[model samples]
Target: MKVFFVTLGCKVNQYESEAMQKLFEASGYVRADEISEADVVVVNTCTVTAVSSQKSRQMIRRAAGANQNSIVAVVGCYAQSEPEVVAAIDGVDVVVGTKDRTRIVELVEAAISMRNEELGIRNEQPLSVVGTVDEIRDFEELPHAPQRTRAFLKIEDGCNNFCAYCIIPYVRGRVRSRSLESIRDECLKLKAAGFKEIVLTGIHVGTYGRDLRCQVSGVSGQKISLVDAVKTVLDAANPLRLRLGSLEPVELTDELIELIKTDERICNHVHLPLQSGSDEILKAMHRPYTTKNFAELTARLVDEIPEISIGTDLIVGFPGETDENFAETLEFIQSQPFAKIHVFPYSARAGTVAATLPNQIPSSTKKIRTNSALEISRDKSKIFVERLIGRTVEIIAETSTDGLVDGLTKNYVRVYLPDENIPLGEVVKVRVEKIFHDGVWGDYVD
Candidate 1:
């Protein structure tokens, strides 16, 4: 049998899809390059925004229609959040959610058997294995190995902070951390697989150990923090470079900062999401930190790690965001030492507090703000790249096309080299030459 996968959403979702692929492959199934050629089609979904959910639905329908005889399976956050909605879609045979993905192959096999028994007749109801996310306590460990230069190891799952604009907590459940030993094992495997970099990813990575107690002999009732997980990955994998997923500003403790500063293997880039710069809008969104707190954290990071690249997520056009509020946000982001900005117009998800709040910003206004923020982001990115000119940086060559190799530096700068002979997946030094398309062009050094 051949299996084709359509993956969407965050890195965590991608990791899960990769794990499911391994399971199917291990069970003697070949991977199908085209959806139409597969015996089974799996659609791993995302619901971070309404747009994402719509895209998930479209992909599921497309996959289902691609091969008439294929067993269609839908999984991940979108499925978890709205199982019935997904099951109602035509040609869907199996519907699993954020939980119980380890059994996905078995579920697909059973669905396939049922389809064959019925002479390829569609089942009256899809096989749904979704459970309440809030009740989940332990992290589900899925077997995965890197197929690329950089491997993403998910050390945590779920979220506790119900940010007013987010639907993630409801779909992903509370914080469930993977055991340190499990992390070590995965790191060892990645190291043995010869991956140059390992990125620690999670729904809320900074909240990694919030739900677990320490297992050390001397430490009693002490909670394991993200710092411990980082230490474990460093000790076990010792990869050429290590990178962190998006982190909450409040959870970036002093100890973690110190570790990032002292550890040479750890990348000098941090994605601390400052959802909104306006304190009023932030409070309305129920984000815990104030603009003052976020400013201080970024300042400290810059003061200590002078060469660090700081990136952020900004949500503009929140409910009740006046002109003054937006001006404050624009001024604040400009004053900061941000290397990049990911701008999103406020998307009010259903079942969230912000959705029902008064004075919702109009779509036209949101569009205007989004474009303005994007302009700033482009300018900031160009400035950051300009600073890298004539400097040598290490990059793991990731892709090659038309005699040019593309890669990313540890600090998250995209560098393109002219020589395609630069081995993919190997760290090579490159001297920044000039700015290219969306990144910088660099000449391979040594």
Candidate 2:
């Protein structure tokens, strides 16, 4: 069987798609180059935001249109939350939620077996089930990276954070992590596969290893924190660098920060989420970290790792955000000046705590705040890139554009090098020429 997989949203979704791809490949399936030629198209959907959910719907219709006779299976968080809405689409034959990745594979087979004329079109079958989706054990299998450049090892699943704004914990269930052995084995395999980097991904990475503690000794066993996980991968010394996914601000500790300084292989970039810089607004949104604590930690990290690229996620116009609070947030961001900012206007989902909160900001206000934050982010990013000018740095070459190849530095800055001689997965040194709007332009030094 030939199959195409479309993934949206978080790195965790991408990791799960890799897992699904492995399942099909193990079942003797060949990956399709395009949706039109595939026997099945499995869309690993994301619903982190309203925009991502809409994008998922767009991909489903696009996939269905491309292959009218092919089996269309939609799975992942968006499907888990609104399977009914996805099922209503014209061409989706199977809609699986967060729980049934294995079942989704079976459904794809069933869908392929059905005749095109017999397939339902007008209305989608209902699949709006909640809570844990997997009835059986999680497959212990580790999925290798689809590309040779990088690998995503999902150490944990689900979230217990219950932030008033996020729909993930509700859709994906409470936190569940893979066993220490399983995580190590996958990292080792990816390193053996010639991958240059392995990103440890999850819904909530900070809360990793808590669930698996009961499985072994140490009585509240230090089964391994995310830091320990990174250390394990580093110990393997497969010549692969370690990069972490988006992390909650509260997760940054002395040990984790120290690891970044001590481990030469760990990337010098950390995505710390500061949803709001106003404590009152944070309380209204039910985020655990206070503005004061977040700011102090931010300063502390910068103090320790002077060259670290600190990126962050910020929400504008959250519920009950007063004028003073918004100003305070703007002031806070200006003071910190993050390397990258993921700015989002608040979208109230159905069952989230902040959805029903009073004093929601107007759309116009949200737009204004978003623009302001973006402008600052762009400036900060440019400054960081500019600082690298004339400095020779090592980077992982990934793609080429306009006769120049581009790759990311250890700090995760994309740099363009004037060389076709560089292979796709090899790390090479390049001297910075100039910083572009998107990335740095440079010449290959060695």
Best by lDDT, which number? Answer: 1
Per-residue error (Å), model 1, residue 90: 1.1
Any runs in candidate 1 off by more than 4 Å, and if so which? 214-220
Which stretch of 10 consecutive residues in model 2 shows the poorest summed lDDT? 121-130
lDDT of each: 0.91, 0.80
> Could you give candidate 2's per-residue lDDT for residues 261-363 as a string of tens digits?
8877788899998988898888877788787888788888888886888999999999888889989988888888488888999988878998988887899
Judged by TM-score, which candidate is best? 1
User: Residue by residue across 292-338, what tens digits does model 1's lDDT show?
Assistant: 99999999999998589999999999899998999899988888888
Q: Which ten residues in a row have the lowest lDDT in candidate 1?
A: 211-220
Global Cα lDDT for candidate 2: 0.80
TM-score of model 2 relative to the true fold? 0.93
Tell how far residue 208 is off in model 1, in angstroms.
1.0
